[model samples]
Target chain A: MSATIHRLDNRPQPSLEPMVQLVAQDMNLVNAVILDRMQSEIPLIPELAGHLIAGGGKRMRPMLTLASAKLLGYPGNRHHRLAAAVEFIHTATLLHDDVVDGSDLRRGKRTANLIWGNPASVLVGDFLFSRSFELMVEDGSLKVLKILSSASAIIAEGEVNQLTAARRLDIGEQRYLDIIGAKTAALFAAACRIAAVVAERPEAEEAALDAYGRNLGIAFQLVDDAIDYVSDADTMGKDAGDDFREGKMTLPVILAFARGSEEDRRFWQAAIHGHRTSDADFAQAVSLIRGARAVEDTLARARHYGQRAIDALGLFAGGKAKDAMIEAVEFAIGRAY
Target chain B: MSATIHRLDNRPQPSLEPMVQLVAQDMNLVNAVILDRMQSEIPLIPELAGHLIAGGGKRMRPMLTLASAKLLGYPGNRHHRLAAAVEFIHTATLLHDDVVDGSDLRRGKRTANLIWGNPASVLVGDFLFSRSFELMVEDGSLKVLKILSSASAIIAEGEVNQLTAARRLDIGEQRYLDIIGAKTAALFAAACRIAAVVAERPEAEEAALDAYGRNLGIAFQLVDDAIDYVSDADTMGKDAGDDFREGKMTLPVILAFARGSEEDRRFWQAAIHGHRTSDADFAQAVSLIRGARAVEDTLARARHYGQRAIDALGLFAGGKAKDAMIEAVEFAIGRAY
Candidate 1:
């Protein structure tokens, strides 16, 4: 029943042993601060938030916040507050995203929407968002507020783009990157950059941390798409091929569909456009994806980005924080089971 | 053909000597700032925002912001930015409110949902909300941000409360006031108080402006409920008795139902609780409301709040801004047809 207990027998062996140890150490401090800041609001908010926060999420956003601040040589404890703020914003968006996507499961647990009604989830999400802004204002840093606010706007716009792009097979790679960057990477980048801003890091170092976060987010999303059909429900926290069932056009599916024959095109049109897909349809789609090696291709792209994320962090001087960040990028792509 | 021109003509007329000039001058500056701040990276965002911003609703929130600042003897133009920020937040909420309420008409024009679809309106409203925070961050005042963010949180909570209370006629007057205060008055109060904060006024003056805005907002909502039952679509820009049709429990209906006879209670139970209301049910409800003089009694309460709003201004020294604010309170509760 423990969501964080992964079945490690089938997991990939990570090469960054030293980095993993450093991240494990930093994560202890980050987790404590997150728990403390999450408790500052009223009981109702934390009660609702606890359902998701304690549900075994990776806490990657907050980790980036804390790690980037440490890498930038932050002497103050405000980075912990900023880290908590980052996680709160990300968590709030997840709560709303589940409602909008009508998702039933998240992080291997029943989503907030499945437990509470959509209205409650939405209002609670709003509460978390406002509370995050209130926390940031308390820091009295206009630069941090501006960066976070703009990132929030970008995230909302990305969701809108995804809404319009759902089931649209014609959506191109550039548009997909834009959408994912806004929805996922913008927050990741903002979280890391804000930590650097708080630490008063050099401009080049701040930009490098931002780039690292962005690339890591993109690579993470790529792996998510690659695992859609291959990962089991127990591992992925949802039914296999749910995106295909919902007519969502992910990268692997798009690539597979593009390489399919005319008959295959008809099959996709029947499933995606007509919304008449069955288990047999899912089987056939999986077969076509395997035949085209779309999943393999997608994973390759994810690895490339993962490497780029690690390379970006080279701008900062090597340290435990930098090593942990590098390990995070690798884990995001495919190391995590 | 302009929505503003028609709506302004039907609004209650004051002496049109000093208040009119002041409102116009304040609104002109506020409107320009609003137009400037609404621009975004996404083209459709600014376009959708422009449609709503130029849609001709009364800029009451911004006016309060400006008046509060002027009364505090603000010598700089930062108040104009704050006033515009207030209006943007209000407009953004309205955009989302119409979608949440499933409304089809606003200011005698089609709702944003009717024009661009619910997704666009909802997302654009979010953009505006985020933009408002960005503008406030530019002002470099953490106190103002805290007040506005808290106001926004309360507003969202109020909306959720209203959604849960819908079609439930058992809601009492105090509960209704709490709901309306959260939904309407919180932002208004924050807007006024923030102006004083920006002006660096004394604490006593800031509290008074907050109280004044709060009372005025409550009075405005009370008058709005009265208009909903009595005014036609042509004048009110919405269907008459819309609240009743939606099974919302407002002040007059709550009071009337409480005083109704057994037979009258049965009628209400069937129409509201049973959800079997028709034109005949509406007519009967209207007649019962008239018979009980519930609308008149509600108007009396609104006028009381209007007077309280004027009294709150006693903390400030008398000036043109103070006079306009007092007159604005009177106009809020007075007839608008």
Candidate 2:
């Protein structure tokens, strides 16, 4: 649900390369549209926005848009603008997410809020958000606008929900899942769903793509949360135990807290409440999470969603596009290993 | 260019009451939609949003929508939701503006950012923005969506432009006009223009309403800036000299700086560069501004736009609605006295 970078460097495993290759041509057009539309007469708008937009994070959401268009076998260029719009929306949310979290780092780089100040970040985020709508409006599709706009509202609502839920262990798994669904998965679902709208495909096909993207998004986020505990900044491009320092109740904490012994539970309560923040506390926390096998189960749960994401494509005719899409889900799940 | 309450308690001059009375019944529906929609299961969103939404500022933008609909004699209820959408956009901008300015007070009340903090303000602003788009999509007019969305983008761009131009004396009246045109007048133009769209009026009428709004919006903002030097917090519900304290390059400051003596210029430069922020400095600023008649001339400039705003309605039939709209413009300019 947060703005942690999700690319994997784990070699000799399933990879997102297939989907990347499949959508390479379409993504180029989308990138052009993104660069062109993000420009403004106001230089700082582009300067602050480019810091994050041209930042090194993978264009996962837009890739879903392009890849879904391919999976439908609908030959049209309308999705290119829409794909750019998807990226703009994602970038806008990322900017705001950094401000909301008081985050210093994203994708191993200083956040826009840190570099440009929250005021510039907030306003540029607004500029990009509005520009995204301009792109959707230019496409002149009410259906596409509805899908993306609704996802945007849901994303904001989910962010607020997560904000209120922060540091509260009692929020439980269902509430946490709901938060991720809205914040992370809604845009993914919308990104894929709009391709069908642009391609003039049927609702069933749209729903199928939505399912594929939504489940994949969840799997991706679950892996991302799991990685925060195990990977140092050198490997994952994110500091280890960041979520723990922030007292984020990712599934690892949720499971460990639920399954921990009484003394361990006491430690977790202090940790989530932010009393435990030192190296020893984090090490102890990692040991507790390992003892409870929370990280393993979180990945196991991600696989459950990853399988659903793959199977959601079952109705689509098998082809290179479909194979790449399936392997993308596998790659998302495989990242945890 | 910043969020300040605009309602006038000054009793003897031209008034917005006629237009308020003209749109009173319709405003009930707009207000209803506003209350119903600002709500979310996330209590903080509604709680924080309601602080600003229910805050005592006049419903100036939505009132323009309703009155413009009356000016065109449009008989439909779609505008109620659309007007609410316009207000949502306005409110969203206000929320973000407060965050950007680090403002503690708005409409004489503590700002939502002050009450709930900046993160809540930023996210709730986002939610409201997305909700505005959803409302437009529900109305299903691509034209209205385009106008509003384009205006939205321009507003954000204008805000960024203003941010960059802040405290910089080089941004002359032309640049200042451009800034207010985007940050202040663009939505006002959109609010009125959309009424014409819903009325199914011709392009000429839409353009006329847009001009009426754009000019009146500029006039309103100019007077608002003027009043920053004249008004006291107790009477105007805004802190006097806020613009002075923030080193805001408002119209009065621009005019005074342009016309001041060499010594006055240094004081003005020092003031704008954050070297002077005490109440005595503000008193000196007001004195120098009065010395150059900058506030008077700023009001005169507002009258120029206000006259154009009233004259823009020349083609419409003479009636209470048109009279009310013209009186609203006069009310805006008259508030400066």
Candidate 3:
């Protein structure tokens, strides 16, 4: 492998800027489509949607679509629209998640719900979702529609599963993986696999890209869960220990609950299940989590997934597009530090 | 035409039982598909969805699909699945609408939100919507996908438009129609048109069914608005004066505001716009609506649309299916009484 090719052992994490720049031209088109589709005569629809869409994120999902298409040597513009649809699905989930989570801040800014209220947030989220389907239909590919639509259903089911499992101390590691896999990885898998379908690539290549994106997504969310326990508000883009406060059963918490002593487990039950918590409780919980080595173990799991993600790209040849994708996987896991 | 055939001039409104009887077997298939699709490993999904689906509002939109197909002499089984999909979309919208409207009761039963809470309601609504799209994909026609997806977007836009227009007395009759056309009529139109599409009928036939459904939906909504003004809590299946309490500018209030005296308009401004109201205020508002002939005028308008709906069915031959459809339109308008 060349110096630029990202490997599993690489300690220095690559910056997301290069991966973003790799598909900067396609990203611009995706942005345009997002803006165009989000417009509505109902001003609230555009106002609420634009607030989040225009708020800066890495646009990582769409970038995956664009990069996967580029790696396959597909020279078509339809992926631009599909990428936009992918982003819409992501944004719609975020909007609804904020409501479901009762979250006030996202990306260090007041959430749309805090500004526009939950009803508007929910309705606008529905509008954006519907708009995503419109874009997909305009693309006129049943295969593409099936993939994205099924991904949407899986995401909702994941969210529902998470809701049902909330605050349950017995939520196992495998169930946690299933939740994030459906909630996060399914969209990523669809976004990447769609590029292959649109390029008229074979099913084998599509399956490979799907595997890559799915593993990368699990790694990304694993790191995010880890960061919630360790990072400051500024680094994590929201309040630290939010998962604990909200009583979420993320992987780290699951590990901590599994490994902790009876007394420590009692503390978790009172804090999370009872929801009678304080800053000191949070501090103690964090101490217990780190003491139990849960955070370290979570990151280790993320690294494993990240490695698997890079391995999933074995079918693609060594090139700039492939390197950036592999490097993007590194960056996803690297978010832990 | 036989006496059984419903004509526009007919004064006696036909019952919906015959229409239900006509599509009885097909509706059973649709219901089975609904129950099948609603199943999930997560127990909460089926529990909540089943509660509402079995709560029993007439499956009017899906019936339009089945009836339209039958009228065209199309004996395919695809319409049953499509009909189920249509009902899912409608049920999904109701689930979301209950959340958006903060409704406590629907169809004489506690709403899903009241039983499960807003988060569950919103997420399950999303699941149903995604399932609807999946059904469309299984139908394997890009044209059907395009029509249904576009209608989904329009329905959402109409809802947002209604949200924006809520409590704004200045919203005119045309804007009101536009809102309902999108929120209500668009789905009906798509449902009816898809029947023709699945049957491989010509474009003209599709357009005719679309028109029939669009007009019928408008008339149905108009009667609903009128019912909101005149009915008791038991009759309306919700609290009487709910629209007034929510400050909704439905047709009766709109017409009343247009024709009422200056002092009467001021009462509306305080009660609806200013949100300063009481039982006495609602009672007075109802008296004023009756005196202004708004209820009468609204029912007249519904009748006009009902006539147009029957007219749109003129392209169909005289038959039980066509007669049932025409009667369905009359039943829609007759609800105002």
Candidate 4:
């Protein structure tokens, strides 16, 4: 345990020169494993999946899975399998979510829905989801299955809650937290936690890893919400203020709306509940948010969660994997520009 | 073994006077359990779920689950949990399917889509899917989870295959069978097979029961397809030739189109492929199908599967439950009118 702690704490930051070289070297291996696992015995599946997997989105979830497993001193190569499963689940959900939301833009390109139609996108999403389970089953660990299945269920439930909560201006922070935790963090936590489980770590170590993942997930989502208002469409690879356009009740907007005057409430009601918003409304809302310092407040909360994520990693011994995870948390908060 | 054989063969048909009486007596109890299980700790979920469950579905999947368990000589009540889980899965799929298909009608009523909108319907469907998994996990059998999860994955895949097969007139019978089996029959087979697993039946008996279920599911889906062409919208609770309208490539149409003359193929291409169909086109297509004996051919296939389903029961002993299963298969094919 002493040696483990020393290794983890003394680990050099991967984003720094020496560790950066190490990650660069391993990146190709990880990418190859991801590509291999994404291939399906069913030709149609692999074709559809390849369309998305090769579509150039960041492999954030899989990176976390691989890093966490390595950090936990995994001797086996099965982390790559779990990592691919994580990405597949994420990709599948994105496909379905885009269709459900009727969004045409993703990653600064036309979504699958825009290219192939919603039905094709949806069915392909289902294909990926099923294929993911097949991959997980190949691992042949009941615990892994249980964790992944439970996380999948939670993720679905959260999405449902968010859908129900949409356009309801009264949505509180607690409900918002619950929704994002389920929709975003549940999978992120499960990705890392399951990696630890696969590595056969002690229960406490697993718990620490799970906490680290959960807080990181929270921070990531919070940062995402904060960036929604400010990031350019080209940079975010999605429409700026898209959440506002969709009447999605996010943290800053919800908080700002709660603190608004009667006139402000009427403005928001007309813009959101009325399902009509112009650039003027968007500008006004942005000004209102800035005036209220909601962005700063939200960013503060994100930083708090991000720090908590880093702190949780301290429960485990230090290593290159832990350092990478810590840097990933920081990157999630500030590097999305 | 002798008792098992007796139980299988001596099962009563629900159409029989005694069996009808028994079903009537137990319907309330089954309905109660289903309602109880459908309740979510989340308030909005139960209300949303109730909108569909109370909308008067026949509860066929749950009935199958309960019937299979009882037939297998299970004395305990865990089957109720599994039965409820089966119905939840079925209902969840329906909600999602309607959203995917943009369907406005189901079971002669306005669909959840019409009532709640697509986003709500989609999310609620997800909620039900997750809730079903939660219920299955509570039964504390990894085997049950494996069966249900696999069924879910297969069903989703089948849907994707069906979507791809849609409007592709070149799709063969084998492809059609695979699509339908995945989309509809897979869950049906799983429902009964899981029941057998729960009962901890002998390996040979379990395999026999699974075969019976698979064949029964095929027959059931075949009858459903047949009903789509022949039954009135009022009776079928869907539009007449709605599959054709939606450009779905069901069996009779596939068979008719495959064997039709060039002129007939042109008419199908115009109606199905080109998505242009007049009343004359509908009438001509129906007549061509009848002329080609495609419907009859499909019925023959259905009957063959139905008979196979009944014969599979020969492995089990004669009993009320077994008799009911055999009769159920007969009713599925015979009562297609």
Per-residue lDDT of B49-119 in model 3, one digit per residue for the tens? 99999878889999889888889989789998889889989998999899889999898889999999999
Model 3, residue A189: what's the lDDT? 96
Error of model 3, residue A243, in angstroms? 1.4
Measured by DockQ, the strongest candidate is: 2
Q: Candidate 2: misplaced stretches above 4 Å?
A: A1-12, B1-12
What C-alpha lDDT, on a 0 to 100 scale, does residue B327 get in candidate 3? 77
- Predicted candidate 3 versus true structure: per-residue lDDT over A1-337, tens digit per residue: 4543446648575677767888999999999999999999888998999899998877889999999999999998999999999999999999999998999999988999999888888888888898999899999999999999999999999999999888888889999999999999999999999999999999999999999999999999999999988987898789988888889999888989899999988888987775656878888888999999999999999989999889888888878898888888878877777
True contacts kept of 1: 0.53
DockQ value for model 3: 0.78
lDDT of 2 by residue, B25-96 (tens): 999999999999998999998898889888777999999999999999898999999999999999999999
- Cα deviation at A116, candidate 4, in Å, is 1.9
Which tens-of-lDDT digit does each residue in A1-337 have in candidate 4? 2433212123333232322443453456666766776564346666666777788877777777767777777777777677777887898889878877889888888888787777667666765665566676667676877777678778877887888888898899999999999999998888889887888888887888788888889988988898887777888888888888888899988878888889888877877774557877788888888877788888888878877888888776666666677777766766433
Q: Give the 10-residue window scoring lowest on summed lDDT in candidate 1 chain B.
A: B2-11
- Residue A158 alpha-carbon offset, candidate 3, angstroms: 0.3
DockQ comparisons of all candidates to the true complex: 0.45, 0.82, 0.78, 0.41
User: lDDT per model, in order?
Assistant: 0.77, 0.90, 0.89, 0.75
> Which candidate number would show the highest TM-score if scored against the true structure?
3
How does model 2 fare in lDDT?
0.90
lDDT of 4 by residue, B1-337 (tens): 2333222223333343333343453456666766886665456667777888998876767777777777777777777777777888888889878877778778888888788777667666666666676677667677777777778878877887777777888888999899888888888878888878888887777677777778878888887887777776788787777777778888898889888999888878877774666666677778899888888888888988877887887876667777777777766776564
Measured against the true structure, the TM-scores of the candidates, in listed sequence, are 0.88, 0.96, 0.97, 0.89
